[model samples]
Target: MQFDRDRFRFGIEAEYLLADKATFRPLWHNDVTFAELHNLMEAIPFDDLPSMDGLELEPPHRKLMPYVVEGYHVPNPDFSPIDILPKGVEIRTPVCSSIGECLECLKTLHDRLEAALSGSGYTLVSLSHHPTEHHFEGPQNKRRYDFWQWAMEVMTTCGPDINVSLPRELNDPIDVADLHRKVNYYSPALAALSLASPIYRGKLWKIRGTVGKSIRTYRRSVIAPAIELHPEENGRMEFKLFEATNRLEDYHAFFLLWLTLLLDEGLKGRSRDQSRIYDLGAVARFGLEAETVRERAGEVFAQAPVVLNRHGFDAGPLNIMKKRLETGRLPADDIIDYFDETGSLEDVLKTRTGLIHGTELAQDSSVNAAALSRSRQSMTGI
Candidate 1:
């Protein structure tokens, strides 16, 4: 399908840990202290670099309105042994309209931050989560703290302590809806982007996406809301609908549905079985939809003939589907092979029989072109 060329853009938001001016170790201080340090740095003129210096400013506290903090322990009135304090600094790169531009901006920002902090008795550590970082009793900013306090009361009742950064540049300008979808669809990939929480409290956590998991969990409890997609109105494969439904339920449900769909495709000899298939039935039992269950068993007969004519049971589609299916569940290989395999409509039709020939897939089905377009735009960052 033809795609909108103007949909690609990139931005970066980097969160840094604050440390003592004398010691290089993680520092825990109140909001006043952090604000003072931030002010001090703001007043200093530093040379810029590609990776660190291209940053626009210490991201104003207002930009982090969307995030909530949780998972880390905070001191409470009932049991207050030692004061728990945490300080953070945020840096946002210049927004680029393309991936290439974004990368260039990132390089500049990275270099600037490095040069500016050198020999300053401070450094910025790139990580999804810091093992030694502790949570303060409350949020650093009043707006964040108040909003989260109310949000937790209305939502899943969790604390907020998460931080996020986006690239400063974009290759293209994206629609608002597409932006949301991009944020939601690529969440797992973004989660994979900086999986630096391998060690928690100075011990191996044995989880690859520790920061991803913690952030997602905290989001679900504090930010995510119950929303649904109307198939007739929104169209199939819409990210908003998909995310709305996915967020309304548990991750297990989402995973089960994804696995079932893949299995159905596989049973028809349309694809190869992934290692996770061994646990399919158990996953299905964990609240999978009846439609998914039926589809899994019936897919072989339903799509078999078409799949046979299309790809002839090659592993490419299966592999791609498996990577998409396994997101947020397990550790995946690079998936570079599958990533490059997604083909055009004609390519798909030549490989799969049921697909309409020489026509957009959205046109042939009830799929919403706008939604699909947005999803693709978000996924490809194009």
Candidate 2:
């Protein structure tokens, strides 16, 4: 079945860690911050959010709540309320007909969350893993908590689940299988672009005391799929490999990248599960520094423009990704460098907490692309 890009919908479920405004440390499950935020959100009127004309608002948004108290603390039938512990909150967008709309919706919800946290002595920070907490003590009877247990009790890591709705035409088994194969092939390399988790267990992660990049992905990749269909949502493919980022432009770029891959019929690259697992490990450790990861990512980025253009979309958002490839530096590298220079995790969290909210709608692709081109030309003496 052929996909008509015009009808495609996009959304995001972004998770953030809660931090103490003063100490910049991870907030515990018992903190009053959770209840305060929840109460404030409940008090907000639906009219506070900007209205999107001609768009169908769904679920949480339709119910006037776009943000929720998420993470390990959220109680379910399997886990009693007493056993539940809060870690952070998740902000999600209603299904949107375009990438721009989706981002706008996300920004709206995030802004609301920031407003609610104002003067509450708490703030949200985007980090793939907890910077200080090495372990969390919790009940361990359920098999579902295996990864959480392995990662040390609470899954302190927070990341975005990039969702794209598949049209009914592409819901058949043949198309679904093909989509899975392509996603597996490209996810490892694409994931390397968003490696923002360099520090883990209170220090820079070291493999046998060597430097490490993303402990979250390095460990989670073995157990999770690069892409999976949302069990409850019909035809929605969730790209699960990316780490969290504070920059709105990063999400802009990532969504477009995945959408391009989903729409591209000419790019038939496929990989077995074992090969993807192997590749993901290298990426999780060194990011683009690994030659295999860089080359594989380069191929996808090179082809992204053609696919995006064919779908009547701009490829300008990809400038940030191209710059990352050119410099061989992902977010984790910058974070590690900052921590090295400051010698304080609190200092790092201070800056990141401030960036938890964003108002920018999209990347200035034209400006970015022009600047990048000039830099490349000068470097090559062209």
CA lDDT, every prediction?
A: 0.29, 0.70
Model 1 over residues 121-226: C-alpha lDDT tens digits? 5544432334343232343222356554543332111111111121112212323343333233222221221122222333333334332223222223223321
* Highest lDDT scorer: 2
Candidate 2 TM-score, C-alpha based: 0.82
Which portions of model 2 show Cα errors greater than 4 Å? 1-6, 30-37, 48-64, 73-83, 140-154, 170-174, 231-234, 354-382
Write down the RMSD of all candidates, one decimal each.
16.4, 7.6
TM-score of 1: 0.38
Backbone collisions counted per model: 56, 1
Give one digit per residue, the lDDT tens place, for model 2 in 1-382: 3346657777888888888777777675666444555676676444433343323333222234666665453334554342335567778776766666566567656766766776677788888887776566655534475654643443566789998875666444437677777877888889999998888867888897678789878877777778877645656778888898877778888887887777777766797888888888988887887657777778888788887776566788788888998898888888899989998888877666633323333343322345434433432111
lDDT of 1 at 259: 21
